[model samples]
Target chain A: MSLAPDEVRNIAHLARLAIGDEDVPAHADNLSRILELVDQMQQVDTKGVEPMAHPLEGGQRLRPDEVIEEDQREAFQKLAPQTEVGLYLVPKVIE
Target chain B: MFEHTVAELSRLLADGEVTSEALTREYLDRIERLDSRFNSFVTVTGEPALEAARAADAERRAGRAGPLTGIPMAHKDIFCTRGVRTACGSKMLDSFVSPYDAGVVERLQSAGMVMLGKLNMDEFAMGSSNETSFYGPVANPWDEKAIPGGSSGGSAAALAARLTPAATGTDTGGSIRQPAAMCGVTGIKPTYGRVSRWGMVAFASSLDQGGPMARTAEDCAILLGAMAGFDERDSTSVQREVPDYTVGLGQSLEGLRIGLPREYFAEGLDDAVARVIDEAVAEYKRLGAEIKEISLPNTHLAVPAYYVVAPAEASSNLSRFDGVRYGHRCEDPQDLEDLYKRSRGEGFGDEVKRRIMIGTYALSAGYFDAYYLKAQQIRRLIADDFARAFEEVDVIMGPTAPNVAFDRGEKKDDPVAMYLSDIYTLSVNLAGLPGMSVPAGFKGDRPVGLQIIGNYFDEGRLLNVAHQFQQATDWHTRAPENIA
Candidate 1:
């Protein structure tokens, strides 16, 4: 029911969030309490109960295979942090 | 004008007694003067609202105005508004201006409703209190020291303060109903897909639903008619016809079977709030409703189940907020990983970061079954409990929150304590049923909301029930003193 500091660090990494060394203890404490709260669910007998994903009872609706959306590269790219030549700019991945 | 309801204003506009431009100006001026104390609005569209109001007046001159034409309203900051800043009450989106209008905004605009501005909310629609908002907490109009329940806190407070006659809100586990109750207003969260979520920012996509908040159920009914419908853009949008919510407002509640879940009345409920709920039930009985004691045995598991499920979904949805595309970006990055991490870390508030971490841990390898899967299975049990209760009753009634609004920072340090405030309201969201909160009475100076829960897509009946109660009671009519 408790999260260790290393575990919190791992979670932050997996979530792609940067947490400073000072904030880890607070996060570990909060996450631990939340886990303890959610830990109450373990007491219930859910042996054969199905896991509910979507609330409604139906599969996703599939649209016909046709191009319907107009290209708005310029309009959408206007809101991006960084972009160049119709591509979102980011730290270089290639060596 | 400040005391008038949306229905009343609509009538005035229809009668040619007042122009939409003048009405819009009065509301904008009131918000400018009074909203500093409440911090309800994030952005005020003064110039654009005037233009829209002028257009509405032109439409009326052309003899082509609908019931809601020329009525001024505000949207929760979560909805995307073209050319307007839609912050979603987060530092991450503080500067983000959307390129297109949300489905709800588009519908309301087409109905001839003028937009006043966007209201504030908890960051990414998380948190029970409005304190988590980067823009600052919304003050409860009834008691300026207390918190307005959130993430629809701004909408509720704005209505309570008479700053706006109508405002849109979203509910992901009691966001709409709780705030409405705390602020002593009326709000409804329609069936999960009753209103389209095409451009509404996703927090927990499965549970997040948009609805209307106003001073009276009749007003909510009017706004709901314009806001609810199917949109192909949202895969989860329900395809059923949206009945005229206003038409059923006059339906008699005679012989209505009302259920009171035993669990909801037990344990942590405040005694004063319980008294208010009891009085409300008696009023319903006088209206010829038959009250029955029902058992939703899995009620206690809602908070735990929600913590796991909502955060798990939010973690996946919010991953799109990296530095590369849109949202906040860090100063410098040695690598792509650093960019994403620092940008997200600096952009998100403490509560948001906490949820992402919890979600990451829950969905991480090796722990998925014990946490995520178990939570989902429990969610089924919770929903099944409601299904059984609804079989014996037409609607369920209870307190919207455990207690009235608490002072800001009272439960801020303890997340579980804050989560428990929503215990009585969360189960309805889990079941994807329509739920509403109406001003039942007051606890001392603060307000108490009586929650009404209905079966799937039963929004019309729910609105009727709230509307009938509003007809008999003056609680919904009472506003905070000095608000004008």
Candidate 2:
């Protein structure tokens, strides 16, 4: 149930987070403890039990396909880190 | 004036004893003078609040005013406030001013409540104590050395200190109730989807619910009525009509079935808190409530299950903050991966990063079934436990937290220890049942809350139960010393 430093690094990378080398051991320790705590769930026999996702027992409410929201692109993009005329500016993914 | 409840303030405003503008100014001044000690408010919107108050006064002059009109209240920093910074107590959103209002904020504004400001909370509503906040921890009003239970710590502290007559809080696993208990205020986490989640920053979508934090259940009733309702924008919003929560305040608790969960009282519960809860239960019995000892056998599993489910959802929800659209961005990135990593790494605090990592690990390939699915199955069992209990009792009662507020930094380093504080309250969220924390009595100077859990969408009954208790006891009236 213990997470190694490499495993902790893998988790941070998978989560798209950067952890310092010194912090990795602590992260590994903490995550391991948390996993140990969550391991208690393993003791319960949940045979034939359905996994509950949403709290309410129903499908999501469907609305008409018609668009209702007014375009707030400029307003929304105002808070963005970087944006062109319309498109968000991010680091180049392709040459 | 500072000590008046929202209900009392509403009465005062209606009777011309106080003007909304004056009340707004007084609260703004109090927050300005007193909030330094408690670190309750993250932002105080004084000018806009006064303008809103004047507008409320005008509406009153025009004979168009509601019960909550002109009443000033703060929002937990989690709610998106238009043109105001809605930090969610995160460094990531430190500079992110929201473009629109949350559904709760919109509805409350429509009800004519003046906006005081945004209150501090655990960063992204992640921590049990407010210490996780980027704005620094909120101090309990009663004992400054003790922690105000969070992630709605600021809201509770502000209410207890009388900085605001009313405030809004969101609870995803005891955020509102625990803090309310610690600070000796009243707060309710209505049933899942009872209040709209639209524009409220998502931590755990299924369990996250917004409710009122005020000095009394009567005040909470007034606030909750305004906050709850079906919103077309929130797909999960219930289609049911929001009940007039104030109507049943005077309802007798005669013949009420109150179930005491044996699991909640067993080991780990503080003796003084148990005594306070016992005294409160005895009062309920005196008021004609039939107390029955019941068992929610799966209660011990709530924390472990929640640690899995909440963080899992939080990871997915927080993925939107990739530094491309909004939130904090790194200074200079060599590449996209670097941008995402450094921006997130530098932006989020330790607890948040730990959760995101845990969530990432849980939802990762080869582990989903073992972690996430297993937790969800345990979730069903916990919910079933409540379902069985509800069949036997009208409402379940317990201590809101294992113990009263502890010293600041006491459990900060130990996440597991901090998680255990919410053992009694998290199951209600897992069950999607309405729950509330009412000031029962004090443990030393710290307050103990008697938690009342009701059937799904039965907020009115929960309010009535808390209201009846408040009517009988003076605990809700006891304010922290030096707050005045």
Measured over the true interface residues after superposition, the C-alpha RMSD of each candidate is 0.7, 0.8
Q: Stretches of candidate 2 above 4 Å error? A: none
Candidate 2 residue-wise lDDT, B1-484, digit = tens: 8888888988999999999999999999999899999999999999999999999999999999999999999999999999999999999999999999999999999999999999999999998889999999999999999999999999999999999988999999999999999999999999999899999999999899999999999999989999999999998999898889999999999999999999999999999999999999999999999999999999999999999999999999999889989999998898999999999998999999988988988999999999999999999999999999989999999999999999999998899899889999998888888999999998899999999999998889999999999999999999998977
Clashes of 2: 0
**Cα error of candidate 2 at position B216, Å:** 0.7
lDDT of 1 by residue, B166-215 (tens): 99999999999999999999999999999999999999988999999999
Pairs of residues clashing in candidate 1: none
Candidate 2 chain B least-lDDT 10 residues? B425-434
Query: How far is A20's C-alpha from truth in model 2 (Å)?
Result: 0.7
**Model 2, A88: alpha-carbon shift in Å?**
1.1
Please give the CA lDDT of all the candidate structures. Answer: 0.94, 0.94
Candidate 2 residue-wise lDDT at B423: 95
The regions of model 1 sitting more than 4 angstroms off are: none
DockQ winner: 1
C-alpha displacement of B423 in model 2, angstroms?
0.5
DockQ of candidate 1 against the true complex:
0.91
Measured with C-alpha atoms, the lDDT of residue B145 in candidate 1 is: 94
